[model samples]
Target: MRWILLAISLLPHSLFAEVADVDLNEVSEQQNAMKINKCCEDNELMVDSVCRLVEQYNQSAWIPKFKTEDGKDTKVKHYRFINGIPRCETTQQRPIFDLGKSEDQLNMLSDGRLLHLIHHKHSTEDIKEDLSNNIYSIHENIALPEEREPASYIYEQDKYCMDKILLSNSNITGVYALICVPEVKINWRDTDFILKKILNPLFHAIAMVLFLLEAIIYFVLPTLRDLAGNIITTISVCLIVSQAADLVRIFTEFSNHVSFMITDIILYISLLGAFFWLNSFGFYIWKTFKSRNVFLRVTDVRKYCYYSAVVWSTVIMMAALAICAHFLLDTGTNPNRKMRSHFSSSIIDNDIEQETIGWLGIAIFFTPIAFTIIFNVFFYVTTLKVIKRINIYGRIHYKLKGCFDLFLQLSLIMTIAWLFLLLSWLNFDGLIYAHIVVNLLQAILVFYVCVVRQSHVTFLLRKSCCYAEPVPTGEWGDEMTHMNGGNY
Candidate 1:
């Protein structure tokens, strides 16, 4: 058979030279039209002689519009599909894939695309939103079990410490393990909460009002604005600032449980001011005892100004150190204060951690206050001792006797108030209420002492109203002169 075929092939071609050539060029018009209709001219991912396609939407389907917390409505760029190629929207700007390219989409996709013969539906709504992600995840699974894994340029949502995002890929599902994150739970202070929101703000407001009143009395009356007047002005200013800060905390977003470094700094600054004035009072008591006199002069006031500068400078430095140390401390164990809008980063939670006596509270505020209170008590005792010694040696100065008695009473009240505060830390729930009551009434207590009861303060208030100036009977006529280190 092979020999016969070879002999037939070897025959001369001249025998069939007149045979007409088959006209392959004469294709029918219907076939040409069919080719035009069926062929895919421009394709993005063409493989195995198959063309991939995607629906180009005039209205965005991949990038979803979202409202931000700041009230700005904008589109979220997370996905992109251009020319049937599914991709992440990593570029700053991209052109439209195929808008107005399809009319009816009778044999086409809607908010969907074809890739490697697989159809993926993507949209801004419902389950279709993650269509591209799912497709890529499924594609990633095509890697051989033992082969080098393709480096991914994407990652799914975290399975721990956030919402669950399970991908439908064999590689991800088979390897994924549910992790148990250690979440820190917080317990707020019920008593402190009441005080923080209600009583504390009330206290601050009352104190602020009283402070302004006293400041006005002193500032308007030159004769009243003496040494104690000077000290009172400073006290008023500190109280005003402290109370204002408290009011701010209550009314603003700082009311949230999260610790804010800036808030802490502000709060501590106010606390420092309060303590500084308190210490200034202690200094005055010390000076009284040392001098064995009740009079001060203009030169003495200047000296005290220098003294105030030195003392307050030390206080500012100490406060700074405390803040630095607080920043250095671990936030995990004691009264855990983590920032609300951040994770795994340091932030100041409180000037005084209400839940526990943290180092910052101790070093910066509470400890200093405690020491100042103690020193005030010491000064009170020493002043009384000196008065007694004076009585024993010489004559009892009748003019200063009333002032001493009133001072003693005021000192006792303040001591008791602070003592209750210290005792409240024992966690006796009832004592906490007592603590709030006493502390909140600080303005009332001060009002009664300085404005209502104290002869000198009462005299100053009356003196400011242009009343006839009588030599103060309790020798308080010379109180300012005496306080400023002058002879009465």
Candidate 2:
């Protein structure tokens, strides 16, 4: 009876306490709990119960970063998102297969499997082991299952299927696997190929022929053998040599490394020589207009010699510096050996090194060419001012006026062409086409302005074999007189 009374006492407190006034609203509030709402921003999405950036947002967030084997962060130049995961697409320093040789041998199946058809005589297991090892060496983060065996297929007819290893990895995308392959070859039917390779070379050839004809006229015609004509002829010669070297480089396959280097050096020297001579020509025009003497006299021959000395010496010095930079300042290793190896086997790393040397030479060469072009602009502007002054005073002859106009036109065309050329080198895509077109049209314009449109040239052409009537020299003499502050 005492035990039963103690149990009742223990249970009586809760049962007896609820008999007071009860609040229904408080009970209902406790039953219906307030829940917090989750929200995500525009670029964020709920991923795995957490707000995370979308794939595009992650991709656009600067360059991708990866942890190197040394535990340092290495920046990846390119990457892609696959299955909401970022995978690097950088070219491996040492690729397993020869990308150039394995062209079209690697393909991706619809089921996310890699199909590699190799002609190697190695066993399937060996090839798979080598591939797996190399892949892990390249990408440290990638994980492969030890028990995973790639599917194999045999092509009996071609014998190219001796090691037809099919790779299947959720982490391995087509881009990630074949990142070492070089960019696709320019399509034959593409506009860029047609314009750059086909039309460009053809136009260059035509321009070369036209320049040759113009050079012959300038040098051979007794009436056009003055100081001005000699300067023009020199410019033409430079262009001719440059164009010939470029054509050889384009069409001839140089098996010898030394031959290729020599050809490239010659091309650069001649190209830079052309611009230097153009700058000299502009200087001559400006000097002639600013002179106190009428006509380019016999004394100007001494000045011409000085100009030649300076221009040729400067060109030689530039060539020497370019050679030194290419050989000394480039890779410390033996360039000749590297170049030979590249030409023999076409190794991509060596090819890249060779291109680096080429670009270094170009940088050295173009620096002076750019300055010459700038100086040419200054000379042109000053010459135009002198001509305008002469025109206002009615001292410029009609034929001489026409000549100056054509000269300015040609100068402007060359300046614009070279500017575009510089832009093309800077990797401006649209400017490359414009650069080619401008340069191609330059030769045509030069021929038309200096030969077809020049009355003196026409007269000389017409009277080729016969004793011609004495050409009027008064227009030239009169222009010189006004430039020298004498009577027109």
Candidate 3:
């Protein structure tokens, strides 16, 4: 009677008790769970001690002294959600995977609770073991049982992690899986639904804005002269190409989620568009130089055979190669990323496709090196000749020549930066520093070309007016009247 009573009393608590998993029969599970629970119990008791250590650090909370993967005592901030769902403070971490926590924490985190089992700031073998075991549990079902895995999905995940990607205005070269939890079955929250709904509209609005701005600059802006008009037109074309690609990327993100492969193909078209953008700038510079120098005889250069046709042909070929390279590179391989078909490799095996594409990339990369060597020499020699002719002509304030010179300088700087990138490609560890330098170089060059051009125009206007009117005569009569548009 006493045994029956005791069993009845324990039944209520048992009903409310959380089990990590239904199958606790595995030898590792039974042993690991007991060991983990004991460790966690000890941690719970030492909350005050842990809190004291955590308070000393601002960036992360301190964990108890623990051994690391290398069997060395290491201090680190370990994150886990309590009860699976995250709290306001814990949700900020967005702990995607739990190295190893009971199933409750995983379900809670996925279900919009900030529940995680945190180990605080420390490394230990036990903790590592726990995390490893947890990850194993979560990922155990990755390869479906009794089902032949799709050929396309063979290396999908690996490629996704390896690829370089642009994400939400910032670039993310890789993502590391720190935790693994089973797919938790949970009800969706209002906030999640709201966020998902607004994402598409926001992207659409941005695309529309880009299109409108491109139109305003390209078709609506009034041009002072043919040269100015052409320059603006070239810039507008560049903007249009880039912005259109961005729009396509945004649309692809949403469409891919909805399972549209056609949209993915359309997205790939953006790569070609970007190449055109690069070519447009090259075209403008080449065109401007050709018209002013070779055709018009503005410069006293009649020695070397500088053919505009050859320069343009080379540029066209380079543009085509660049487009081909982007496709071959297939730098974006994330299956989980929006707009990417999870089974994109199914249509054509990614390895074979990538390898085929890579051949084109190699060709493109080498061609650019050759083109740079040949074209840069020609460009520089032409520049020197132009400068000499300008001095001989005694045109001190030659606005067109000044603008052309600025364009040439920027192009040369950009070309040098590209060369640096090529050299660094073999050692990707230096990519961050190289990227920053390239960005700074580009910004300064663009500012010098775009902003300084305006300054030059203003300076020339002042210089021309000074010669046109005897320094305004200091008294202001007919000269002042003319300056004021005859208002007086």
What global local distance difference test value does model 2 have? 0.54
- The C-alpha stretches of model 3 lying farther than 4 A from their native spots are 1-221, 228-356, 365-373, 390-397, 420-427, 440-444, 456-488
- The estimated TM-scores of all candidates read 0.49, 0.53, 0.35
lDDT of each: 0.44, 0.54, 0.34
239-313 per-residue lDDT for model 2 (tens digits): 778777655544322222325576678878887888887788777767767876545555546877988999999
Clash totals, every prediction? 11, 0, 25
- Which stretches in model 1 have alpha-carbon errors above 4 Å? 1-200, 251-259, 292-300, 330-358, 392-433, 466-488
Q: Better model by TM-score, 2 or 3?
A: 2
Measured by TM-score, the strongest candidate is 2
- Model 1, residue 30: distance off in Å is 39
**Cα miss at 308, model 2 (Å)?**
1.4
- Put down candidate 3 lDDT per residue, 135-233, tens digits, no spaces: 222211122333332221111111111101112222211111212122222224543322323433343345445434433432332222233333433
Number of the predicted model whose lDDT against the real structure is largest = 2
